[model samples]
Target: MPEDARKRARRRLSIARGHLDSIVRMLDDPEVYCVDVLRQIKAVQGALSGAGDVVLRGHLEAHVATSAGRGDSVELVEEVMEALRYR
Candidate 1:
């Protein structure tokens, strides 16, 4: 992966980690609002999605764009399709 993309993905994951910690703490508090917990959960999901996007973009730029000349276009397409199956 490119250095910049790796750094950005790591930063988003760090934010997600912090939000996950907050969610755990909130779970321990009997008075915490359910909506607030859901919001934190959403934040974590968005961070994870952002990380996935960065990695996919990097892959497309660094590999997929060159697969035709590399003679691996078929395999690369399948791999990318599997990776994006959830999305």
Candidate 2:
């Protein structure tokens, strides 16, 4: 929720959007190589992974830590465990 975190998230999303656009362009252009497409796919995956890390860090630092500080650690742990089960 901090301005810096929001900016970083936005930047990552923008990179993802650019990757999508590149894929579309590649599809339209017959000369695009198969390896190039694979590279773009990897880039998109890495960007998404980076974004997930950012979000997880924020959640741990803000929500989880705060909940634990407030003596609601058990609830927070249960919620995380339930989420993992669903995953």
Candidate 3:
């Protein structure tokens, strides 16, 4: 992965981790609003999605684009397709 994209994904993952911790704490608090907790969960999901995007872009740039000319793209393409299927 490129240094910049790796850094960006790391930052986003860190943010998502913090949000998940906060959500766990909130879950333990009896007075916390359910709607508010749901909102935080959504925020964490968005952060993770953004991080996934960075990873996907890095793979496309560093692996897939270069693999095509080498005639070894089948596995790489299948892996990307699997990821997209679940995403």
Clashes of each: 0, 0, 0
lDDT of all predictions, in order shown? Answer: 0.93, 0.78, 0.93
Error of 1 at 21 (Å): 0.4
On TM-score, who's better, 1 or 2?
Answer: 1
How well does candidate 3 score on lDDT at residue 54?
94
For residues 1-87, write the lDDT of model 1, one tens digit per residue. 788889998999999999999999999999999999999999999999998899889888888999999999999999889978865
Best model number under TM-score: 1
Q: Which residue window of length 10 is worst by lDDT in model 3?
A: 78-87
By lDDT, the better pick of 2 and 3 is 3
Which of the predicted structures, 1 or 3, would earn the higher TM-score when compared with the native?
A: 1
Residue lDDT tens for model 3, 1-87:
888899999999999999999999999999999999999999999999999999989888888899978888999989889879766
User: TM-scores of all models?
Assistant: 0.93, 0.84, 0.88
Q: lDDT (0-100) at residue 34 of candidate 3?
A: 98
Worst 10 residues of 2 by lDDT: 78-87
